[model samples]
Target chain A: MSENSTYAEITEAIRAHDSFILLSHIRPDGDAIGSQLALGHALEAMGKTVHYINEDGLPDNLSFMAESQRIQTPPAEPLDVQVCIALDCATKPRLGENALHAASKAKLWINIDHHISNPAYGDLNHIDSTSPATGQILYQLIKSADMPLPDATRDAIYVAVSTDTGSFQYSNTTAATYEMAADLVRRGLDVGTINAQIYDSNPYRKIELLRSLLNTLQLENDGKVAHWELPYSVKEEYNLKPEDSEDQIDLIRGIDGVVAAAFFEELEDGKIRVSLRAKDDTFNACETAQLFGGGGHARAAGIRMAGPISDAREKVLAAISNAIS
Target chain B: MSENSTYAEITEAIRAHDSFILLSHIRPDGDAIGSQLALGHALEAMGKTVHYINEDGLPDNLSFMAESQRIQTPPAEPLDVQVCIALDCATKPRLGENALHAASKAKLWINIDHHISNPAYGDLNHIDSTSPATGQILYQLIKSADMPLPDATRDAIYVAVSTDTGSFQYSNTTAATYEMAADLVRRGLDVGTINAQIYDSNPYRKIELLRSLLNTLQLENDGKVAHWELPYSVKEEYNLKPEDSEDQIDLIRGIDGVVAAAFFEELEDGKIRVSLRAKDDTFNACETAQLFGGGGHARAAGIRMAGPISDAREKVLAAISNAIS
Candidate 1:
């Protein structure tokens, strides 16, 4: 159990270890699952035994990736692995109980993540907050260490970075991101096919949710703040999953002359889920979220509060108006 | 007019010319205006007098670029210049009559574009249809010729290619497109700021249009073909301009099970403007468009046919269902 590990140290550990298990955050995203597969595939290419496990297994949307089936639920018993690697997880507990129990047998622990909030709980940590996605960090690590990059690793890396960066639309995207994508394309990654799968494939429920949300959309504070609400009834009517409404707030946030956008949704548990997005640094979404004991980044943040959707919307809109003013 | 010209030949023309006028097609988009600005700024940096003129002028969305102010409407009198370079236009007349008149005084005509249908209607033509955008072509020509890349040219090139490639998500996006973007970022492009301006800024009217379109959305052929109609009445009610409804068809096109999507808009002159987008090569949008005497590429095409909107939708949807089947 040492301190922070360099790319060389990480690579050396990979070379030295015989068996490994990889885990990412629960309710896995492209970065979470993609990071594990990318580094896992690279290790497998080097003739190392690697197991990929996630608390929630893989989401239905990510089933398009041919090798995503490698990510499975943790077995009933802990596996006989010498080293355990945690990727794209901000904290140890976020990996879920079953995943941790499955990795308990590993003698050594390695943590690789890009979240600034990560506590470096692993025995050996490689935390790079400046990197937009853990996938980007793995790409740098693999390239720096000259790891064997299989086609699985190549496409996985692109999806991981591309999704985390909002298909390279987010402000966090860097020159290295584009450079990495360019290299991946040169390595035979089909940008069109992958991008279509990632962006164009939307469930019909999502559109129904969008139509419902738009019906509830409103402008306030002289059109500088735009907000919308979704009652639990609409969710029931559409039989919508939580992921169905993901990023739907962008519809209002994208409106010109609006500096801030807010989405208020009523949860079945009698709580309101609030998502806030700011267009610029002038208004801090995290700060506004913090006012309600929630947290996130400058431009995007989330909150959960007691609701009757109307009351929740009023309180949040007031805070947003105050912040932007 | 001479036949096809090489990169070297186009460079030689630029070097030889003292005064130049740049023009693109009417209803200029980011690629059209961006290509003009990118090459115009480069030539201006090389001590050449450059006049930036377009028939329809810059769209409001693209005005965020600082150098975009240079893209002006064609003046009544023809410009006195040694050369006129038409960028991103497929046909000569697409540049509009006013733009052609403005360029009438130029002795040499140089056409640089990425559209495959472009006729070689210039004294020198550099048409690389394989390139995704005219901006990518300009970036390559500038870098290959070792021309000075001013900040304006660098930013302009990024926007040109980004918008044309749907932020590099389209099938036409190439490895070189990503490479060019990487180069622009390295040369001090603030990708976050520019991208926000390009993507996040949408007028409220656009959202209104989306709401109206969504209400009319329908899925036919067992959800394989999705179609939506926009009646002329809704346009009048929303006080909408044509640009407000641009790309709205993508909402339906992106549905998970949809193989092809169509948008039927009732125009003021008893015409229905139909835009068809296919998800894969199996559904040839151009072929279907040609059935109604319209044409475009394999994946995306358009047709303007006589309509009551119902008849147009029925005809187009059937064609799409047949194509997909």
Candidate 2:
């Protein structure tokens, strides 16, 4: 009924339908989990049945969310949801294998995200790149639904926004971000404790992995570009999962004189996952990821290549060098 | 005179003295700068002429302190100071070359610090190991002096206390620490802006270096220890100075299972400066640093070894292996 039929319209679609399913991107980050869980909480608060699914397991760091365990891989039963909402995912294919199928099967599909690269695959798309995180858009949608947010919902939304914006330190943080944070804070969310748990609470093994990474640092092109790689053996020795190395790339990128930093993790499948961070305006890692059929923000980005480690390294270096030159 | 003679006695010594100088230990951290500057500010407020000397140059990151520019290296000026007060230094030898000379020349010598290992080298030593940082002691001393604290003095004191206790997240943070911080906040110090400036303002070059470090990560000793090194050539190419790598050791120490993280930086002199951080209760990097005649706290420590890279690596690894085994 509303003239502005994007987010509000999507909310109505979700309410009008009974059972709902939520999905996010492959190798999901905070925004994906945040948008998924926040919407799920909102739907459940409204007395609607909702199921959240992600093919990849929840990242260890984000496992603290209340409904994290409820997020399943996929339902064995055929997609029975009247409506399905894909949150914080760009392309439909990014939903991995299971959720992608569910998205196709649902009678009404709604897409909600903040990614500029969103493919708009759903029957209804409500994407606002201006929002700092998908959680912000979901907050607006929840408000429009005339439902009061509970404490659990507030916690999830706060984390969703906080993690995506790098704890309000990144450039993406805007006035809206602060307003949303203040709102969440007012809802009995302890920002300081949450920040400590998210950023400060680190297990010992992750520290070891970081030390190993720093040991092999290399710089090129007059220190304008920095690169490092972790072989598969190192992961096995350290008993380190991919998630354990999540924040390592940022450490190297913080060195003085480094314009860009690239980290290579040799996967068991003979593929290399490259995490890139750009420190200066002269380099854009997202564009670099795009060249390899991947994309992310300018400051942080990644690409996955299935090939020999050396070959993938050479290719990535060539692409980055060419871009800088 | 107050019954607590230690603080009053120290304040009077500083006030009565003409041509006074202050010094801190080598590789001074926030506590060192904070204590030095707070004392300097207090002395200036009380109409006493004061000179501060740090033989080593000021760290680039802490240049925001008001007295950072006033910090002087000892020159050929005759040693006319009636007294020298060493703040936050464990031992007289820890004072760098020039400050050491100044300390020896003063008519009266005093040592004020919070290190448990302090040698009590000064003629008048006020060492309180229970105190979180020397800034706390200086706060008491300033209060006892009944000198009005200016905004700059409050800022310097706050920086010292904040950084030393890891922004109130570390184990060293206590009720006393909070009380001091609360008082500083009451004096109109913007805690958020200070924290943002100290922790959030990352240089582009630093991010690039972080990326490089992350790329080369390795996990050793069954994930208990993570080791990484940055060679001088790489640092030179990246235009990164030694100070830029300050937090690399801490980043590695944050891994999920890692107990210890060691970052080895190859100095221009071909010496490797190993910075260590411990995440677990079992491992102590400071003890490891002590094996090489360096010292620090249990969680964080450092050592400088002069040798061929391979030899130094082997020695350091052997020491670490011994510690864990």
Candidate 3:
């Protein structure tokens, strides 16, 4: 029952607690940051002391979703809380093992997530793999407690749901996902404003990266595989940081008739980082990534190997071929 | 009384009719085609003959939603129907003088739309300016008719809704929009498959076009305006046509802090075609385009001007400044 604790039970546990410390996964994504912030806001509204912290702080891409810069990294000492909730994290170590004191100091541990792979490590757990985003799970938890739906919290959750689901363009987007978005809109969510901040704004560096990407676009295996190898020089020449390369695979996967796509970036450490995406999970992206000591979901996966770009490219193509075959 | 016709009344008219000819706008966009197809399918299910026709026929991009290519252009000879439905067309002129034969043959005319500018030319009309799209109005009409919702119809409406609202990225996207999308998903909308077909499948020509656009990216007016020019030679070089540049404005407008964006293309007729997008309606893109003998919505507008690229650029920048000031 505890493993399958309902939102009602999770709400009761939250209400029973006073001071709560919210933790986001390291190098947190919008879902991690948004759900943590939304829950933190909800808890504060319920007259609870909420402290939101993340080890890597926040990335500029997601700073717009944070409130008053409430999320602190290398959090202040003398942390005091009755409940510790891990938001969107699969395991305890995901909360940054080195920063354990902040979470370990709590009296109760609650794990709330939407990942099927998340092990129920907390004393009480509320996890639903059906949810496209953890913010969706937070939407339920906040509702089960019958708290007033604040506009800011609604917007935060909207970011969580939208970013994870590619603004409802991804496969996981469901009837429930759109319904939640409608609810948020009804609650005064500015769909355009939020979307513009999350997606419309792109650094010029992305364009520079795109130029490098398009020049190297290659189709293989009868166009089943569309791929590109980005030399580290592209980043240096474009003045782009590593994170700027995110979502570049989209250009590859979007090719018509393309079933599998790969992006290889030459890292400075003489290692090549490879990202793989499959149109269908049956291709087993995770299994392919595992061959090179990497792991991710079935539709998207990644790995890093110490080698030249050519070797990594040949190896990744082989894994993709094996997976697809 | 006609302009204010309720969904309940509109439903009655559809059931009373035996055959229906659905007319969409010239060069039909997704909203026009989608709403037409959904209503056409609904009428067919109700034991009525449904003729869905467009003067310009379906764009290759939208053929996936055509449902066994039911939508015809320069429709069959001897067209006859009892009811005429104008969908998403702002005016009868949009139906084209050639299409008048099929539509005028009907005894009853029903107009369903969400555009504020619609003339309400139908004997019975259901128009809501507050709704983001015509497919939304169709959703209401179908519900009022109490037709068994089918997957094909739902999918069609979703395509209509998502496309008009730019996949829920535009300001028109409201809570109702998400709710509608959620409902469609529950009814088995394959969001990923549809989105990939509609938005993701970019032709290689688009990349070649982007390369030309990005190479010429320039900023002006204290970075208030970001723009690019596409000389005719680039098209000739890449074997690209005008459609290849459809979403290129995204690359310019997506630049951070760029309030107004422009794309200039050298037209074949010794003129320059300019596309404008304003960050806000206050910028009045339509007003700017109007100066060049063109018009469009407030945020997005286009015009063709008899001038060199430099002159057009200077003149348009001045107009944008005037609008902003």
Q: What is the C-alpha lDDT profile of model 1 across A210-295, one tens digit per residue?
A: 98898888999999999998999899999999888887887788787888989998999989989999988768999999999999
Q: Order the numbered candidates by DockQ, best leading.
A: 1, 3, 2
- lDDT string for model 2 (A1-325, tens) is 1122466667667768878888988777777887788888777888888888986858888887777787777765557778888888877887887766755567887888888777677788887878878988888887777765877678788788877766554556655565666566556676556666667767665655765776767778776777888889999998886678876676566555666889989989878899998866678989999999878778788888886778887888888888888
Q: Which residue pairs collide, candidate 3?
A: none
Give candidate 1 regions above 4 Å deviation.
A1-3, A269-325, B1-3
Model 2, residue B63: C-alpha shift (Å): 4.0
Q: lDDT tens string, model 3, A179-264?
A: 88877777777878888788876877777688778778888887788889888877788887756787778877877767888999
How do the predictions measure up, each by TM-score? Answer: 0.93, 0.62, 0.90
Score chain B of candidate 2 by TM-score: 0.82
Q: What 10-residue stretch in candidate 3 chain A is worst by lDDT?
A: A72-81
Instruction: Name the docking class for model 1.
Output: medium
Candidate 3 residue-wise lDDT, B1-325, digit = tens: 4447978778888778798888899988889999888888888878889888888877777887748288878554547788889999888898887677757778888888887888899999887888888998888778766975677788889889888998899998887778878777777778888887777786666766776787788888776788898888787888886567887787778776677899989977769999999876547889889987999998899999977889998888888888777
The top-ranked prediction according to lDDT is 1
Model 1, B1-325: lDDT tens per residue? Answer: 5367878988998998799999998878888989999999999899999999999888887889877989999999999998999998878988999999999999998888887667788888988878889999999999999999999999999888988888899889888888888888889999889988888777898898888888888899888888888899999998887667767787788899898999999999979999999988768898999899887677788899999999998888888877778
Against the true structure, candidate 2 reaches a TM-score of: 0.62
